[model samples]
Target: MSKHVAYTQFIDFEEDVKIRARDQARVVALREKKGWLFRLMLGLVLIGPGVLVMIADNDAGGVITYAQTGAAYGIGFFIPALLLSGFIAYVVQEMTVRLGAVTHRGHAEMIWGRYGAFWGWFSLVDLVLANILTLITEFIGVTLGLGVFGVPHAVSAAAAIAVDVVVLLVLRYYAWERVSLWIALGNLVFIPLALMAHPHWSTVVAAFSTWRIQGGFTPAFLFIVLANFGTTIAPWMLFFQQSAVVDKGLTVHDIHHGRMDTAIGTVAMVAVAVALVILTGSLVHGMPGASNLDIQQILRVLGQRLGPIGEDLFALGLVEAGMIAAIALTASTSWAMGEAFQWPKSINMPARRAWRFYLPGLLSAVIAAAVVLIPHAPLGFLNLTVQVVASIFMPAAMLFLLLLLNDATIMGEYKNRKWQNIAAFSIVGLLVALNGVYGLSVVMPHLF
Candidate 1:
């Protein structure tokens, strides 16, 4: 068995090296070409990890959170909040692109390599726990969304897991990423759905000037704020993007393209997010118990206000959100595990040789999907709670990220500048304070 495994690794390694050589040769050739068309072609080639991560960031949990936000509070406050979150997402994720390109190392490997075993183990455990929890929410979104069309929960969960596994294991890295991106485009379904709602453009534009939560600083208000932050900027995103950049074989030369990719994705993410909020805010915001309704109830409201077709479109969007996120999350889990254990980590490697690398992610997805199949699960609360949990864990993740970005020995000239530090520090500071306030709201119940 040992000899067989070693032989498979050797074979996979040789094949992957050839694959990378061919891909990089094209990249070098493209770099030398000087024309608008060539530049556009180069941008398309170099744009994968950044855009995928950003799109996957708007996963099932994100869809639910944004929808809930609009249902509960209207579009007044969160429209601006989502915009701020997008800025924060770009600021934080852009750093990862540079870190990965400069160091050619995954976030897990760097944390372990530079910070000692204790910190490494801490980060790995945190990421795995958070990722599994997030995957459960993704599965919940999948099953619940499909439930709209009378699809059985069991079938949806099983089918989602099966598709997710096939996509992860069947393709090498490049094909896997391209397929995921195509699916991610389904996230924009919410835009047309929003337009179908015929929202008051004047009210939507006025949200920026009237930036205030509908219900003062209540516990519900606090939860939505933190949940929004959590969904927008999760811990898993950091590990996912950095590992993706490493696996994609992006280097310093591609950093400019990486930045462009991230920028494009950020715009798309914010656009979809705002669109969902608009759809729900227009249709469900004034309904009784809007703040507390589960996604099913929210869908019912949308159907009554918009119609069955609108409801179906929203459900389709939800399923796509789950599918895309599951793909990205499963890959991230596999990559982090492989990096930490010093296993062969690239998706370019044959799955037969890297089964150990693939198993953890697929296993997590199966478990999450199974949990969604269980009867009488409190999935709605669980979805928001997972996002809150991510928010709570985010400060620690950001701390590691900031430390890595500022390390002169590792990052050298790529080390974060003063403005980057200020922006990052502010994000971390806001997360910490929000977490503290949420804890107070739970404990004291009357602080606000």
Candidate 2:
């Protein structure tokens, strides 16, 4: 009688244990489903900064430059020339991906700490001046583009200032970046616009394959290429991406997604640049000495060839480009200033913790907006001002970036790797020498 009772009790215990195991499996399955949703959301959240950085990298200046390159050279050279530096961009930008992931520091802070105040102040001063002037140009772009749409200069400048303020004030970094990424999508319009030009695909193909140079590769072309490269890689991009990574709290684990984000960004930029070239070349090739085009002239050309709709679209795209760029440029100014001052410098930080960090960006944006709308503002002088200053300061800026990338103290194991340094230095040397030759050509007249 006792043995039968004990066996029955053992069966009861076994049934209870099996019920618990089944319940546990269901709970595990529920969590697994939740994880998939969480990751999808995070991936969307993680997408913007890299892409915005890349899109903004293709600023109004770049659009005009690519247009001019195609108008002058007919895409024979830069189609492939653009490809060469694309991975150079991918490789160079990838390092910032790692730096931001590992250190969670902005470029200013890294240089300041790794080298000293001397270099730190140097970088900060350069960034601040370049950023201010560059920001003014973005506003100029916005105003010019809006003018084509019949928006008055004073009204458009004021509206642009308002837009920048609202975006900076209302959103946390996450929301701000996502909104900006949507704005950045305007640049994609160039792809359809470019295709609408009815370019001979075979001609585009031949241009890349043959690598033809007009009148056989003059110094002027070299300078133009160097400037294009400069446009591709800027000091602010390094600062902006790193600060963005730090703000997003990207840690060692997120470096994979960050690098992937950067690769995607690199592709977006190169594609847009190529599209700009094709758009200009298809419409304006073989014109009577039509190489010297600028932003305002590009609109005239678009209006002439594609009718008012195409002209309006290009203007709208340019406005969008300037808007997106203004956001990044202002953010970069804020990040670098905050880092240099040792103030609370993160977009992730609560407002109180980082208001000092955020204030300078707001002020700089305001000043830039004001200056753009002033009557008889010596804008032609300002246009020359930006180029002269950028030319004067470019070498120093590139030197600091190279120095920082190579500094084992900052980058540690992630230092520029030998081959990367070769490309970097080669780019730097080429740019420097091209400037020299350009100056000579300008003075000599016949050499170019």
Candidate 3:
């Protein structure tokens, strides 16, 4: 491992953690015994993973999805709908915590070992390609957001890639993670921006209990729905979380806290997602000229209503969202490639130590940046393609994930309990059926 942070690289973090078991337990106890201190400490210690997960989910495409959702629905039902999406995200990601801890292996490695090369190749292909495309979108968000601040696209794109290279190549895991977390956590700027919109609280609340669609299911509704689903959870999330757990050297004892981290991320994601939908939906969706606008278009319209400040905040949130997702996606691609090919891959290692592990990510960031620069590319269709790929790969991803979690050898005594299995399978079934409906709605426009 490269010269990195003190905790994990120099020693077996899994074993060394045992030496500090006393302090670890004390920290947990301290968190429980106090209120404000617990909150503060929790924020300090548990901040990275949650912020990463949430912001990664809210990638550039996600912002566009939320933007479009707000323009069409006007905060009618999507606010509460996002609550369910967040819950789903938590339930799904929490499984990876136990899987990573119990097995001491990344998801790709586990799948390759147990299921053999066919499935391993399947998973890898999905992760690498999806990651590359997703990174491109992140660059797009950054460039577009910078456009709001009067930066040239080429300069912003080059600067963003350079910053990523420095973070990945120069910074050690601890510093890299901390910097990424701070940038990712800036996704919460949306909350204050939403609050500034001054939406009617009663109407927002009613959108939840009213059980009414703003104007019934339309093509725009379908677009936002799938986009929301894609943004909330995807193949990259699983790959990233599992690899993170492997890199972090979490053991069985930390599974509980790991799950807690996932849960915190879930709530924060929904809070921001809902706030965004409600902010735009209530403020601009039903305005005289607002009708089924996309995210970029929505930002411009929101500026018209709330002035430059609202638009600027939206742009800032968009950039943060993209970069946050890019960090996770790139990390995920590196880890999965490393594990699948049996290369040395760990954030704890320096770039020299794990050049093979880190190079894929760097190259991906470069290619993605280039992809964003292609003249008159059909970005709208490319976003649609991302969603389509997610739908296609989801069943296989969930199946492999379930197989690993249910395997007695891997999970040991911590295998999925009945309720966990129920939740997992239920999610799978629901997603399958939901996609089917979405498909039918696309083919037969009047049915939904």
In order, candidate lDDTs are 0.90, 0.76, 0.78
Best by lDDT: 1
Error of 3 at 283 (Å): 2.1
Cα lDDT tens digits, model 3, 43-107, are 46544554577667888887777776777777877887788888888878888888888887888
Q: Highest TM-score, which number?
A: 1
| Candidate 2 displacement at residue 371 in angstroms | 3.0
Q: State the lDDT of candidate 2 residue by residue for 1-448, as single tens digits.
A: 6633532332233332342343334333443565677666556656666787889988766666677778878878888888876776776677777777667677887777666789889888888887777777778878988999789988888888889878876676667778888889898888888987989999999986687788675766766765677667777877888888876666666677787788888899999999988998889767776776666777788889999988988888888877888889888999998777667665544566568877888788888888888887765346434544565466666676678778787678767789888887876776677677767776886775
Ranking by TM-score: 1, 3, 2
Residue-level lDDT of model 1, residues 202-296, one tens digit each, is 99999999888787889888988999999999988999999999888889989999999999999999999999999999999888888888788
As a TM-score, model 3 comes out at 0.89
State in Å the error of residue 111, model 1: 0.5
Residue 353 miss distance in model 3 (angstroms): 2.1
Candidate 2: which stretches are off by over 4 Å? 1-41, 216-220, 349-353, 375-395, 407-413, 439-447
Worst lDDT 10-window in candidate 2:
7-16
